[model samples]
Structures are given as structure tokens and as C-alpha cells.
Target: MKIWNEPYLETCCRAALHRLVLVGGGGRPDGLKDGPCLERLQGMGLARLRADGRYELTEAGRERHAGEILKLRKAG
Candidate 1:
């Protein structure tokens, strides 16, 4: 029942999901924006906090979000 898993991810906030999409797209968050979702993503190795205080998505994160996008498209 990991938060990054599809089931949990489906229930996560759109804002958090949007952040993941941004990170996956090579956009970095500029500050410490720690919260339950971000922390869980970090713990799951999906997102990471860089030494420069920016957040970037890991490769797995990109893949996951890609899959999510596909699912969203199909669901619509």
C-alpha cells in the first residue's frame, strides 16, 4: 500500500500529482516544500531533494507519471 502505488496515487491531491509531473518534466521546486505527499514521494525514491535545495523527480517517478498520464487519458 505504498503511496506511490497506482491506487494511492489515484487518491492523492492533484497539486501533489501536478508537482510530480513538473519534476518529471525537468522543472524543479525552489524550496523545502515538505509535506506528507512530498515526504512519502521522497521516501519512496520517486522524488529527491538536491543539495541546491531543489526537488527533482527520479527516473522511476518519470515513468510512473507517464503511466498515470496514459491512464488519465484513457479514463477521460
Candidate 2:
């Protein structure tokens, strides 16, 4: 995770980054979102959410991380 350029996205509640990113896009941070970034990252096999309030990085996630993050992809 340190190797990636992932900006520390501020989440309303601890959860998968997909939900946070989507919700942080000026939308209310509810339990779910109309469009979650999780699905895209999921497609990339880079991120996931557990039953707990945590979004974790997978093996592929480390590889996608270029460590050039200037800002959160979507920050509210």
C-alpha cells in the first residue's frame, strides 16, 4: 500500500475504498452508493471489502500502485 500512489481517501465510515471514493464524490456517505469505485477496482482485482469495516488491498493492488498520487481520485 505504501508503494502505491493511493491518496488516503477520507471515508465517512470505515469500509471498502470503493464505497468511500464513490461517496466522497460530493454525495452523502451512506451504506451504499449509486456508483461505487469498488466495482472498478474489483474488476482490476486490486481492492476488496470484508464483513468488517475495512477495505484491504490484494496482491494486484500493490502492483497498480505507482506511488504518484497527487490527490484522492475522488475527494469530497
TM for every model, in the order presented, reads 0.61, 0.38
Per-residue lDDT tens digits of candidate 1, residues 46-73?
Answer: 7777777556777867776667765787
Cα-lDDT of candidate 1: 0.63
Error (Å) of candidate 2 at residue 69 is 5.2
User: What would the per-residue lDDT of candidate 2 be over residues 46-76, giving only the tens digit for each residue?
Assistant: 6665556444555555444422121344342
Error of 1 at 5 (Å): 6.9
- For model 2, the run of ten residues with the poorest summed lDDT: 67-76
Regions more than 4 Å wrong, model 1: 1-7, 23-34
Candidate 1 residue 69 Cα shift, in angstroms, is: 3.6
